[model samples]
Target: MTAEIFATTPEGDTVEIVTLQNGPATARVMTWGATLQDFRLDGTPHSLVLGSPVFEPYRSRMRNYGAVVGRAANRIAGGRAPLNGATVQLETNEAGRTAIHGGSDGCGYVNWSLASHSETSATFTITLADGQAGYPGNLALTATYSLDDEGALTLEITGTTDAPTFCNIAHHSYWNLDGTPTLGGHTMHIDADSYLAVDEHKIPQGGPQPVAGTRFDFRQPRAITTPQDDPKLDHNFCLRLPGTEMHPACTLRAGDLQLEIDTTEPGLQVYDGSGLNSEVPGHGGVPYGPHGGVAIEPQKWPDAPNHPDYPQITLNPGETYRQVSRFHVTRI
Candidate 1:
């Protein structure tokens, strides 16, 4: 593991950037938000993801660019949910009425502690106090990023709570295979028969709806900006359940670069960078605009607390939470 001082927090805390290398792939991870600062392959001239060159933009501008999001990965309606047969009010950070991504006090903004590091892997840990984000229990979470010689990067997140709480951790990385100005030409294919429908505020309507005959269908590879593509997409695509084994969830291709996203989670949220308009220049001094990249977040179904039919997101006192996801890039 190679480390360097990345930046210092406003509170006078030190933050570092750790780099893990394996064969042709190199990943630079920052302690702030446990975020992926840069990912590059040996022969590639451009970085694989959209990210700022400094820490300030990550905190002030970039929506969740390559951060470890949690407590709850998605929204909870009315800023409240049921816990132990009672209502638990949550901190509202989205439009002042809903709790999105653990209410802005989420793990994405916290500086995680470096748990351990080696040549090819690094682990970062964060502790979420009970009721810190309006959730119960004290949650101890660890996010580990590992890269193999075969050019596959795996992110494994594990958590354990001291009391009953809601925990759904997901990696939020905006990927741009070629690091181009726009991802409109990128081809994408998601392995999902149905996707959760969302309302105007991007909240899940009720349950999963069939993707057939709809723009959500990605059973086959298609250009991301085709007529079938929606102007803005923040919906969660429902995958096969049980989630005991990792499987190929989606594939994104841009020219000669291809990225295969696989995960053990049953849901994948696809964001096409529609709302990205950043003043801070990304790596290589490129200003990221709308559709600058695409985010493929793998985790539990959104708003699971209110919908009993969806998969559960609860973590009991003695239970452990685990999610495994991989991003494998190759030249086509």
Candidate 2:
């Protein structure tokens, strides 16, 4: 276990990138909510690959950059919806369409303090101010980053909402296993048999539709950019039913590197990073150019507050919310 000063860009930020090396895997974690900076397998080393000719200043565009995203990880469908019969309104930040993740008041910006850190795992915990996002309940969120002796990256989130509010936490890390901009070569396979149909606003419009007849099916495993897929990959997949505990959700691979992402959440949002700010300055202490990484976010469905049939993302009192996502790295 080793630590390096990543950057101090967020202004008065204590961004610590903790590196954990176990055999063939090396992972970098930021104290800012335990964000995953980079996860490398067999020492391929693209977690923070920059300073190249075609790829200069691409790290800045990282949305989560390697951090935990939550309160609600996806859209709230206009950012204003009712939860548990209570009219909970949120700021609309996602193209005037939905309340993505949790909104501007969402946890995306909050700097969760590091609760603990050690050789194999690091834990980050933060408290959400009351009336912070129009929700009445105070919240305490925790994310634990751990790398097992077997070379797998584990991210576990535990949070409690005092009031009735949605609480689906997710880690947003853009992955570039090949260490290249163009992710057209990466392949993705999700276990579910169907995906929810969405409207133009990127909001769910229909129930789980079979992947059997659409390009959404990945049961056989194929490249994400394989001609059959749509140009922009930004839709909330009605992932495999999260039965009772943590389970396998999808397998993502780019060239020689592969990541097995598992979560306890019922759905996963696989963003293609089509609009990722290649121009956004990243925490690698430099500017990131276009397509630096691909974000495979595992969480409950977006706007679950409105969809009664959908799995609940809201956390109420007397109930403890727990979602664990594992990024098991393998060299192929």
Please name the candidate that would achieve the greatest TM-score relative to the true structure: 1
Give the lDDT of residue 105 in candidate 1. Answer: 74
Off by over 4 Å in 2: 3-5, 9-11, 48-60, 242-244, 280-292
lDDT of 1 by residue, 251-285 (tens): 99997888998899999999878888887899969
Give RMSD to native, each candidate: 1.4, 3.5
> How many pairs collide in each candidate, listed in order?
0, 20
Put down candidate 2 lDDT per residue, 33-89, tens digits, no spaces: 456656666756455322212112212334455657767777777667786666877
- Candidate 1 global TM-score: 0.97
Candidate 1, lDDT over the whole model: 0.88
